[model samples]
Target: MKQSDQAVVFGKRKEPHTIIIARGSEIRHFTVRPWMAAFAGSAFAALAIGYLLATSYLVLRDDLIGAATARQARMQQAYEDRISALRSQVDRITSRQLLDQQLMETKVSELIERQSQLTKRHGRLGPLLDRAEAVVNGAKPAEGSAPAKPETRVELPSPAADTQLAYAAVGSAKNPFALWSTRNSAAQADSSADHADKLFVTLNQSLRTIESEQLARIDSLAENAYQTADVISDALESAGLPVDADFGKADVGGPLIAVDNPSMFDTKVKELDEALDKLDKVKKEAQRLPLANPAPGRSISSTFGVRRDPLLGTPALHSGMDFRAPMGSDARATAAGIVVKAGWNGGYGRMVEVDHGSGFSTRYAHLSRIDVREGQKIATGDTIGEVGTSGRSTGPHLHYEVRRNGEAVDPLRFLKLGKKVGQYL
Candidate 1:
C-alpha cells in the first residue's frame, strides 16, 4: 500500500481522523473530522431518500394519468349531452312554428276562394232577380228590350291588407337559439302561436256563415222557379196540350262535387235558369192555346155537354158554351191564331173559326157580323166579331167551342183553365 493509502488518527481526544483505500498498485487516503463525517452521512442519506421518492413517482405515473384523462372525458361528455338536448329543444320549437305558418297560409287561401265564389254568385243573382220580378209582375217583357246584364262589381280585401293580416296571424319575427338568449323568447313564441290560432278560428267561422247564407238564397230561388214551372205545366196539361217537350227529362247526373266548389253554385244557378225558361215557354205556349173566354164579363147562358137544345127542345150534345151578351158586344178570339173561316155556317151563323195550332181550334159562333177575314192573323183578345143572336142562338149571346183534332169537346173546361192561368198571370 502506498503511504497515501495508510490510515492515520490524530484527534486530540483520539478520535478517528483518516481513512485509506487501495486498488491494484494505487492507493488513496482521505482525512475527515467528526463534523465532516456527520455532514457527509447526512448528504448520502438525503440523496438515497430523493432516489427512492423519484422511483415511487415513476411507478405510479400511468395510473395517475389514466385517472385524470378519464375524469376529463366524463366532464366533456356531460357538456356535449347538455348541448345536444338544448339543440333538440330549439329544433322542435322551430319545426312547430313552421308548421303553424303553413296551416295559416292554407286557411287563407281557402277563404279567398270562397269569397270569390260568393262574388260570382252575387253577379249571377242579378239576372235571376230580374226574371223573378218579371214572373211576379205577370207582364211580358217589352219587345226588343235586352235583358239586364249581371253586375260584375265585387269588393275584396286589398293585397296589402291581406299581407298585413297574414303577418299578424303568423309571427312576424324569426326565433333563434343563442347562448345569450333568454327564456322570454320561448314565451313570446308561444304567445304568437296562440294569437294566430284564434285569428284563423274567427276567419273560418265567418266564411262558413257567408256560405250558408248564399246557399239559402240559391235554394229559395230554385224553389220559386220550380213552383212556377209546375203551375205552368199543369195549366198546359189542362188545356189539352203536352206540358213541355223536356219537362221531366232534365239531365242531372255528373261527378259528385263538393258543395263549396264554385261549379256547384254555378250548377244551381243553371238549374234555376232552366226552370224559369221552361215556365216562360209554357206561358207562351199557353197563350197560343185556346184557353181564354171569347166573351168576357158575360154570364154563361148554356154550358157544354149533353143539354136540352132550346130550338129543338130535346136532349142533344152541346158542343159549345153560350155566353149571354148585349147586342153588338165584342166577341174576341180566345188565342193568337190564323182565321180559317169567317162566314156563316149551318147552326153557327156569322161565325169565325181560328186555327190556334197544336191541333187546337176555336169557334166564335152566333155573331151578328164577322170582323176577321179568312187567312187573317189575329192575336188573343182581338175583336173577331160582334155578339148577336144569330142562326142557332136563343138570345144575344156568344157561342164558344174548343176542338181537338177536329173533334168538338166541351169548352167549359178550357174556360176554367183560362181563369186559373189568369190568376197566375
Candidate 2:
C-alpha cells in the first residue's frame, strides 16, 4: 500500500516488469520484481490473435474447396455428353453401311438365278425346235441355230455373306463397319450397291429378249400342230372313218390374276400340249382304219365283186381280192386289230378275221397254214397266216377283204388312200 509502489505498478512503462508473490500466515516476504506479469500479458495477447487467424483460415478454406469441386463436376458432365453424341453418330453410320451391303447381295443373287433358269430353258428347247423345224419345213434344223445354245452365260457375281453389320465392303472385309473404322467404309458400301444395279439392268435386258424369242417359237409350234390336226381330221372324214380327236378335254387350269408382266411360258406350253394331243388323236384315228395294203408286192390275181371263181369254175360274187403269192408266204394284217376268227373255215382254208375298233374289221382267207390265234392282238403289217392252195383256193394266193359293220368294202379304196399319205399318219 505504499504510494511509490502503487505508482510503479500502475504506470505505463516500455520495459517488461517482474513481480513476486506472498502468502498469509507463513509471514514470508520477498522482492516485488521476481514474477513477470507484463510478459504473461504479452503472451496472452499473442495467443488471442493466433486463435482469430486460425478460425478465419478454416472458414475460407472450406468455401474455396466447395467452389473447386462444383467446377470440376460441371466439366466432367460436359465431357460425358460429348462422348454420348459421338457414339450415336457411329451407330447410324454402321447401320447405313450394313443396309447397302445387304441390298447389293440380294439383287446379285436374284440376277444369277434368273440367268440360270433361262439357260436351262434354252437347253430344253433346242432339240424340240429342231424336230419342229424338220416336221414343218420338211428339212433338218440348222446346227447351233435351234435355241442357239445361248452363247456362254453371263458371269455370276459372288456376293454370299458379303453384307454384315460387323463386316466391311463387298470384295474385302478388312475395314469394319463401326465407329472406330478409320476407312471410308460407308462410301465403299454405296459403290457396291451401284455396281449391282448396273448388273440388274444388263441382265433384265437379256432376259426380256430371250423371253420374246421363246414365246414366238412356242406360238409357231402350236400353230403347226393345230394345222396338222385339222388336215388329218378332214382326210379321215373323207375316208368314212370316225374322227375322235378332242383337244380341250385335257384338265388345264390354275389361279388367274391380272398382272403387268404376265409369264407367257406356261400359257404357251399348255397350248402346245393341247395342239399335240389333237394331232396325235387324229393321226391315230386314221391309222386305226383298215387302209393299208394287206399283201404288199403281190400281184392281184382276182378282182372283187362279180368274178369267175378258179376252184368253182363258175361266175359268182367275190367278197375279196386275190393276191398271187408263193407257197408259205406271209399273209399280213393291213390294220391293227384283235383276231376274232382264226384257223380253218368251210370256204377259207386258214382264215383270220381281225376286229378293228369303230365297227371296222379285216379278213385274210385261203391260207395254207394258220399262224394267228383267236383273241390275239395284232399290228399293221403283222403276219396272220401263210398263203397256199387250200379250201376254195386256186393256187398259192391270199384273199384280203375289208368290212365295215359286217358289210364288205372294196379293199382297193383303202389301199389307195393309205399309200398316198401313209407318211403323215
Candidate 3:
C-alpha cells in the first residue's frame, strides 16, 4: 500500500477510480477522476428520479383532471346563481315601477271624472243663476220674448287641475291652463300620488261649497218670487176674477233640461222656475184686468152701488162710478180688451163696452164721440171716446162701469187695489 492509499483508507483524502480490461493476452487500463465518477452517479440518480415522477403523473392524470373540472364547475354554478339573484331583483324593481305608473294613471282618470261631474253641476245651475240675477236687477222678460240664454262670468274650481288632467288624458306637450307636468323619478311619482289625493279632497270641498251656495241662492229667489205671486193671487181672489184660469201659460221658451234622478240642486232650480212662471202669469192677469181708474185724479161725482138717478129724480140702480169732467175731455179704456159696443145706446150716448177676458167687462159712457169701433182691440190708457153730456147726463161727466160676469161691481174697489199693487205689476 502506498501512502495515498493509506490516506483514502483512513477517510482523510479523495481518490479516483480505475478500470482494467484484458482480452486474448491484450491488456488496457483507464483512470477516472473523482469529479467524473461523482457526476456519473449524480446523472444516474437524476434519471431514475425523473422516471419515477413520469410514472406517477401518468397514473394520476385522470383524477387530477376530474378534480380541476369539478372545481371549475362549482365556481361557474356559483356565478350563475349570483346572476339569477340579481336578475330577479331587477325584475322585482321593474314590476314595482310598472304598478306605480298604472296607479298614477288611474288617479288621473279619477280626477278627470270628478272634474266632469263638477262641470255638469255648474252647467245645470247656470240658467237658474241667470234668472236670479235678472230678478235682482229688476228686469222682466218681454210679453212674448224668447227665454234668455244662460250666461255667466263664474269660473271653475281650479284651472291647474284642468291642465294636469289634460296632460294626463292626451299627454299634451303644452299645458293649456297652467304649468305642464313632468314625471322624472320614482320619488316624483310617489309625491305626485300624495298631491293628487290632497287635490281630490280640496275639489270635493269646493263642490260641496258650490252646491250649498247654489241651493241657498235658488231658495231665496224662489221664496221671493212665490211671495210676490201669492200677493198678486190673493188680490185677484179678493177682487172677483180668475187667477190663472186662461192666462197661466206664458210665451216663454228655452232649453228644458230633463234628468233621470233629480238632485237637490235640480229640485231647487225647478222650484225657482215655477215661482218665476207663477209670478209672470199673475202679473199678466193683473195688468189685463180693469184695475185702473178711467179718469185719474178726477173727483167722482157719484160712486158705484145704489144712487139717486139725476135725470129721473127717483131712487134707481146706479151701477157705475161717475167721474166729473169738462166737455171734450178724453175718455180712455181702463183695461186691455176687445171693443163690443162703440155706438150710441139708449141710456148712455157714444158708449164703449169692452169685453175683457176672464168674464170681466168695462163700459165707458156719456161720451159725445166714439174713437174705438166694435170688435176693435183697445189697450189700457187708449182713447176710446171723448167725454160729453150727450145722453141722460146733467153735465159733462164720465161713467165707468166694471162688471164681472155681466153683473156690475164696485169700480172703486179695483181702483184702490190697483193703487196698492200697481208697482208690483
Q: Give residue 61's lDDT in candidate 2 (0 to 100).
A: 88
Q: Residues 65-159, candidate 1: write the lDDT tens digits.
A: 99999999999999999999878777877676666667767766766665666566667777786786576445322223323222222243444
Which pairs clash in the backbone of model 3?
Answer: none
| C-alpha lDDT score of every prediction, in listed order | 0.73, 0.68, 0.73
lDDT of 3 by residue, 1-425 (tens): 69888878787655456788888799987898878889999999999999999999999999999999999999999999999986775565456545555654565666666567667867876776776555434533333433333322445666466646444433321222121124434465445546655665665576566656656666666666766666667667776555775554457865334465436566667878887887777877788889877887788999887767787778888889999998888988888999999898887877999998888999999898888889999888899888898777889999999998999998999998877666566
Poorest lDDT segment (10 consecutive residues) of candidate 2: 145-154
All candidates: TM-score: 0.55, 0.56, 0.56
Poorly placed runs, candidate 3 (over 4 Å):
1-197, 240-262, 273-288, 297-299, 308-316, 324-330, 386-388, 394-396
Q: List RMSD in Å for every model shown.
A: 14.9, 14.7, 11.1
Return the number of clashes found in candidate 2.
2
lDDT of 2: 0.68
